[model samples]
Target chain A: MSTTIKVARPVDWTGIFFAVVLTLVIVVPLLVVGTWAFTNVWRFPSVIPQEFGLKFWYQTLARADVWSSITMSLTLATTVTLISAVICLPAAYAFARMDFPGRDILFFSFLAGHAFPKFGLLVAIAGIFLQLNLIGTFWGVVLIQLVGTLLFMIWIPVAAFQSVDRRMEEAARDVGASPFRVFWSITLPQAGPTIAAALLLSFVGTFYETEGAWLIGAPQVRTLPVLMISFINNQPVIQYGAVLSVLLWVPSFIALLFARRVVNSGSFAKGFGA
Target chain B: MSVLTIKDVTKLFPGGTKAVDSFSLEVADGELVCLLGPSGSGKSTLLRMVGGFETPSAGLIAIDGEDITRMPPEKRPTGMVFQSHALWTHMDVFKNLAFGLKLRRLPATEIKRKVEAVLELVGLGGYGSRRVTQLSGGQQQRVALARSLVLEPKILLLDEPFASLDQHLRERLREEVRDIQQRVGITTLFVTHGQDEALSMADRIVVMRDGGTEQIDRPDVVYRNPQTPFVAGFIGTMNLLEGTVANGIFTRASFSHPLAVADGPATLAIRPEALDVTPAEPGAAKVHRVTDYGTHGLLDLDLPDDTRLKAMVSHPAQYRHGMGVNLTPRAVSAYRNNAQIFRSEA
Candidate 1:
């Protein structure tokens, strides 16, 4: 009779304690916010909900304030993802496969944005958005996000495309494939997961963006985070104020699932080697 | 007329690296020519020019008398295989075999028939449906051949195709490639840094160095009567002696007796196998070391002036190191080309 032996992996209890405690720190507030949205009468000193009702949710849904903001944010994120994809594929291919002028300078310039704070661009970008007659419009918000967002999207796929063996492309050309066919059939499919990851991360970046929304989305375009702030600032300081926080997290959950599939595929893992 | 004419092709890189300077050769139709050289010898760059991956900076490359110097790679009637079999990873073996045919817009039925025929020919009879990633390394290489051969291009270019494989596989695949090229009667150009691969497969061999042709001849002609010293040294290991030749006798730098020589101040090159090692009947050198490499043993010996000469011998038990042995050069040919590498440089 054969028996199987289980091997034990050592655990770090102190590290685990901090990890669990920190996770609870983030999660406890989130759950409390969801609970607080329903409780009608509440006091911090009481430490327990006195009532529960769907009134806040009902009111928030009916006002058209939250819905319009959600729609606006989705529209803005979609625009940025689509536009960023256009700039990313060709730029990534050129950087990865072709030898062109300003290659290093161009690549580092894209990375330079991530080095500095995105908020630093708010004042200058707001002024430019205003000058371009882009304030309070979906395109206006898209224009501002495109600068910061595209740098990351390009970085991920550039590495992905480069990670595919260059000899493969040379072989394609040797087999009578034109440069375009080689890219379509050989290089692109190999880098599929990396492109997907880039898109998901780009989508997430646009979805949670508040500064661009708050700065340029004034007067007409009010995104989700902006509207959430407005509703929380409503008179009486109701305990239902925390419900707006739930709205902020919904799209992030969707993005997390999307990013999981892309990141786990082996194709994207090659991007690190490049 | 030559099937391909490379007229004085010179390749100078932008950074002033003379990769293939004024190099030229003619490959007749249906001839398997191996461009043989060591690494950085400009053999690969010369092959690329023929495949249309590279354009010569200053010469005309004509395929079957038609100048293709300016044509793009796709338009050229040539097929190339690499050191690594560059199979399309996304496509199945059948799809990969059919891709070039599909690009030419052949009908789907015709594509299927053609792909099946090629798969059978390459010994992948039941592998048309498998993805390239699923196949073994050797299988992937076979698919790469099927992919290129299906197009039936006028010329086939292989750049060290078996260099990526182990020795056993390399030997088997080289034979397979030779057999296939012969069956198709396609003009093929094989490039390699290995002398054995070139010797075994090529109908004719073009030895290149420093961006120019060193020698172009049948394998035997190049071996027996190497026109230049570099060809003799690079093609196979040869014992070179610095000597001055006068009337078929060479006066070596180390020895007093006048040895075999060319007409003037000459370099002496002798193959190891050409030097016979045996019990002395007349004149011989003493064996310094007997290296037995299973199949044969190489006897390292010193001549009159302490200059060493190596001979491939058999039977490790026949002789011991430090024993006095005789040398009789069974074959000696005096070649007097200006490209003869200096004895010192060798």
Candidate 2:
């Protein structure tokens, strides 16, 4: 099938080749940083490290801030995940199913916020939190991350709920089931895999994100990304930032490996939208 | 008693499309009435309004003389079997049937017995534990039936319920549905575009078109005597010939058929089977085309003018070359009820 399908144009070939080069260039740097975390030293401008040991890993654990950073990252991600699910489920349903005045305007406003980078809101958001005396609270870090989490995660579930057949709900209503019962039984069960995928994506994505956490959060509420940055600044010669990167990415990576079902169903439900 | 009454009910959707315009019907208890129409003819919208899935823009609906115009579907004593089965895909057959009962908080023992009995009634006794998708299309449809039957609705409504099944399966399931309807004797209102389905299964057929009732008659009466040109054209395959009526006898274009019109100019309609091939006589027609349809041949007879009349004849054993065929239309019907027929503008 592949051989006889069609002749490839030069433009298509160049596009494919350029994409592969770009992916390799970006991924290889992250791969090196990951491998360097376990090795003893980076000798020169060589592709591979000369000395390999776990001295940096042991010394990085010796600092108590490593544990605090792990806890901070976990807490901020968990809180963001809970808030996103609670706030976004109803919002997504309202956007998908109901019709009111200014509905399209409201939806487009959400899309605008989603398009705007989180860094644009960082300084003003920090100032607001400081004035409210919530700067040192763990919940403060979560509030700073809330806007992006709702935009990105709610879009997935909104598309999921809309793809469901309205006839199914009508059929349930015809068979003596109330509207709420139909929503609970037929609608939500079908949306299970998408919700799970969105929850995982929001939590894991926020865990590794540095911009929101680094700018708005105070010193006492430092997340793993902020902690990792401070650790690198204090021990520039030790290269513990590389260790912290691997440490931070491992849990999220494992969660993602088992997330194929969630992604497959979420992507299928989220057709032509997110 | 009138089990269901739709009195002056009208549904005006957005943009002024009157889906069901001032429609009304009084279905007697235990009668199976089929609302028959082509798509976009407001048959389904009427059914939806009755089921409360749609709120009518005008008029009122009553079940057993109680007005339920604004009542939600679940609150009404009505159940509907959807065309696609609409079985709870995530649930097993057992839970699917017992869903409404469980929601109403029926006792577990009564729910168990009712579910078991209906499942057996639908010939899916052992399929209770199986997922709805795991079942065949026929089985899933039976599950839908069981789900609605468990509710014991005063009148059961079906929206092209067996349409998704194959021809043979649909025939068998409609027979099953009829038998169950007879045994339980609940009033039923089913909708279908297929004439054969409505004719064979319904106690009374309501033919709808252009948001109004075209004809409401029994199957045999409707087939033998159609009330309007649209009903005749839509219900079944009819060989129509354009003719004019003056005095009493109708003057067809080619051959003058002995049709009796009531008042003014008219059009006469004849079923293909009404005309038969006879031995060629002085005023008879000559055969133009013959289509052999297994046991019978559908022949088109050319008259003096270019007007060709259709006839259905059983294949004779000795049909040979140069054998001339005659035409005879017996016990046929004529309509001059409206001048629209001769206009030919519609």
Candidate 3:
């Protein structure tokens, strides 16, 4: 008997099309900025740089204001990540494990905080900060950034804590660990990846935040992104801004790489039941 | 030896649902007592209270005459095995076993030795480095047991630790758990809905229903002499028939079990295995259905009273469906107003 073989398609064409579109949308801008960072001169309609060199990269790194901007951005991002994580731990725990009157309402309020448009809220916050004479201060910038990142940080860890089995906590307690120990050993370890993701997101959010720093810390405190925008307004220094933007992209890329493994490990309960 | 005592323990959950009501029991050290009941019967809730996971609304739980009712779980000297085994996924088998030992600040050498010994005890001696997720269900269960066992707790609370395993594994693990409990001689409180688990493993089975203790007795006694209709029906397959007691005879539509000295509205209880099915010239019952298991068969008989009685017969194929047969109960229990008033001779 003769059999006719029909070849099957190897890939989903529609999905491939969407993926290609998304990759181009995300990757083309990075490629353009990267090219510009090394370009000496590239006018409109120029597909590639007319002259290539590392002068912009060195200038972006060596400038005193740029150096301080980098330092200030690092400090702000680190502070935001640390504070967001510390403050959200207990709040997330309450949201995940407790059932009191107004618990849902309080959680929903946090969600609403996250949902509110940052630009509109920033204008109001800037006015308030100006009235309080808090503008142009480091703490003032941090406070505003905290308002933007707090809800996101809490929202993530709440899901992380909720995914964990309460029985595991109870088991830890049964084995003679104190409640705080249970939180540290069992609850916190189980939520490691999710917390890492949240912190990374918080750091990235703060480091690249332009409006918050511009509105709250302008001239006095110029973070990397705000400094990038400042460079953009100058005709000769725009390439340096592209270099700075690419420099700011490094930590976030590294974070993404680490997050993929941490989130997927899901090692919390290898054989342990959900 | 730890003697765990629960006195007047009542757990009233939010919304006024009584998960455990005025429950009390005494368990001597090394005794493995099982709480057997259906779901929502408060077995797990009672065990949680004993483990100090849930505070009793009103009552006292004392272990070895020391009141531990208000103590936190960490200070209560109890180790619990959750139903899902609840082994920490972040830790390997050795770390899981050594967790409690580390908390106690035992020396490194002592913790290592104790962990290895417990792993060996649970038949997992060489699995110390393996992640818990790498182990099979049965192996993970052994790790959970070992984790608790290495703690050397005064009381071990097991909440259906083997409930998730397949039938063969469940059977093997139940025996292994019982063996381990015997060797360790720790006072244990086991909770399970499976009657077979309770019957085969428990020294005394505390049968519960609707937040109340139905009967507490030796497995043989509980199986043979269930005190309440609920216990009889819940613990095993029981043929319950409603009848009235008059003229020293308890009579259903056509079925009768003699009551030597009682009269009232009554319920007749007979184990399916206790009733014998045979062909009779004047048989008043017809076989409605036959379900054949490997070792025995269950015959559903339709009686004149419109009540269908289940009878276990060894040779099921000999009696066809709709076949005329007579059911003679070799042993029986009679309940008056839900309480047993009569038990037949063995």
TM agreement with the true structure for every prediction: 0.87, 0.90, 0.92
**Which candidate model has the greater lDDT, 1 or 3?**
3
Better of 1 and 3 by TM-score: 3
Judged by lDDT relative to the true structure, which candidate is superior, 2 or 3? 3
User: Between prediction 1 and prediction 2, which has the larger TM-score?
Assistant: 2
**Model 2 DockQ, alpha carbons vs. true complex:** 0.65
Error of 3 at B228 (Å): 0.8
Kindly list the per-residue Cα lDDT of model 2 for residues B77-177, writing each as its tens digit: 89888998787777888988888898889999999999999888877888889988889999999999889888889989999998999999999999999
Looking at model 3, residue A62 earns an lDDT score of 80
Docking level for model 3: medium
- Which stretches in model 2 have alpha-carbon errors above 4 Å? A1-16, A45-47, A50-53, A237-239, A251-274, B279-288, B300-309, B316-325, B337-346
Assess candidate 1 and give its lDDT.
0.79
**lDDT (Cα, tens digit) per residue for candidate 3, span B308-341:** 8899988888888778887788999988767889
Kept native contacts, fraction for each prediction: 0.74, 0.72, 0.86
Ranking of predictions according to DockQ: 3, 2, 1
What DockQ does candidate 3 score? Answer: 0.78
Q: How many residue pairs collide in each prediction?
A: 6, 0, 2
The residue-by-residue lDDT of candidate 1 on A1-274, one tens digit each, is 9999988978889999999999899988887888888877776678777778777777767877678877888888888999999888888899888898998888778767667776887877888877888888878878878876877687788878877888788767766779999888889887777687788788878887778878887868887777776666764655435766776677678777777775676444554433
Candidate 1, residue A176: lDDT? 71
Q: List the residue pairs that clash in candidate 2.
A: none
Collision pairs in model 3: A270-B133, A271-B133
